[model samples]
Target: MIPSLDWLLEQADRKLKKEMDPDVIAITRAVITELAAEGLPVGVAQAFRTKQEQDALYAIGRTRPGKIVTYAKGGASNHNFGVAVDVFVYADGGKRAEFLAPPDPRLKQIVAAMKRYHMQWGGDWGSFPDYPHFQLYDAVNGQPKPLLGPRYPGRPLFAGAERMDRTLIRLIQKRLRLPLTGQFDWKLTQFIEQFQRQHRLAADGVVGPVTWRHLFGFQR
Candidate 1:
């Protein structure tokens, strides 16, 4: 059976309706349905991102010490406002996945889907090509949709409490080279605390702005 879209939406964001614009969601759903019908079952890898998350991705290979993953800064990316999503084409009965890189044979299909839904594919960009990204069109140059606003403000999202955001926890695990359990378990908490201590931030297990800065802003 195919994965439930509702569950996928929840995985993308806990407060999806609250975090994402209704128009984006509608267009994305239509695109997904068309893709599924065309036998290209795509799954949403990312949808909404906080400013800190975007900054962290942008910091890679720049201010931070890793391969550059993005060109957009915190407020620059469409993802920071929940109008964008990253998708992966599933293979092997959804066990394996394929990232839609440039010149890939599958890109034509994805781009077509994006067009049908009035979304823009990042792969078409001349500079800093993003293969797996798509976003709703902004109301410019004859585009039909207006750009959405940010959902997560540029502030500490967590303090004095444990975070239940599976996506953020998974990102932290990937950054720390830990197993991607997608769970903020005791082990992950310990790791976060240690990371915080080493970074000269508060050793609280809570993942606040300070921790996010160190986690995604720069390398150790």
Candidate 2:
């Protein structure tokens, strides 16, 4: 009874004028078309569940149905925000009007489509693994400028190492006058690790920012 966000909400903006993120919507339509081609008529699900439906469900002894359905934070779902979609599998011909499987062959085709478009399939989640779900994952730190203020207060994440490596390696080579030797290939890595230890950072040799500073600024 969730008053889902149907296509109607997408057509003409009544007040909010805001549209769904284009990438998410495009990926969704592609999956739907591909699923149809594979022979299941899947349509979008109700995204924004109506208040009436919420009240009715509340009356029916359910305060939050997502606690029963989802593994992720309940209201803070991709579906609720319209970046995710759910598809059902209904057969073309049947003795009675019915849908046989959630991962009907048709549904599998949708999964394939999502992957081709670089979208993540919900079925990949080990904890939840919703086969009928497809979602555009939120970008982490791929932006030109990293977002300010830590998302986690103290979680110990070490992302962006690849790009960070190129920069740190350059700084280290310039500072200590190491044999750049035209290629870091191996020797430079060993030098960087020793440099990291002398600087009091972990000697992982991964050339993080702190390691870069010690190699260049602190003259270690």
TM-score of each: 0.56, 0.42
Tens-place lDDT per residue, model 2, 159-200, is: 333223343344456665775433454566677677777767
Q: Positional deviation of 179 in candidate 2, in angstroms?
A: 34
- Go through the candidates in order and give each one's C-alpha lDDT: 0.67, 0.47
lDDT of 2: 0.47
Q: In model 2, which range of ten residues has the least summed lDDT?
A: 148-157
Give the root-mean-square deviation of each candidate in angstroms: 20.1, 15.4
RMSD of 1: 20.1
Regions of model 2 farther than 4 Å from truth: 1-19, 48-67, 72-75, 92-103, 139-220
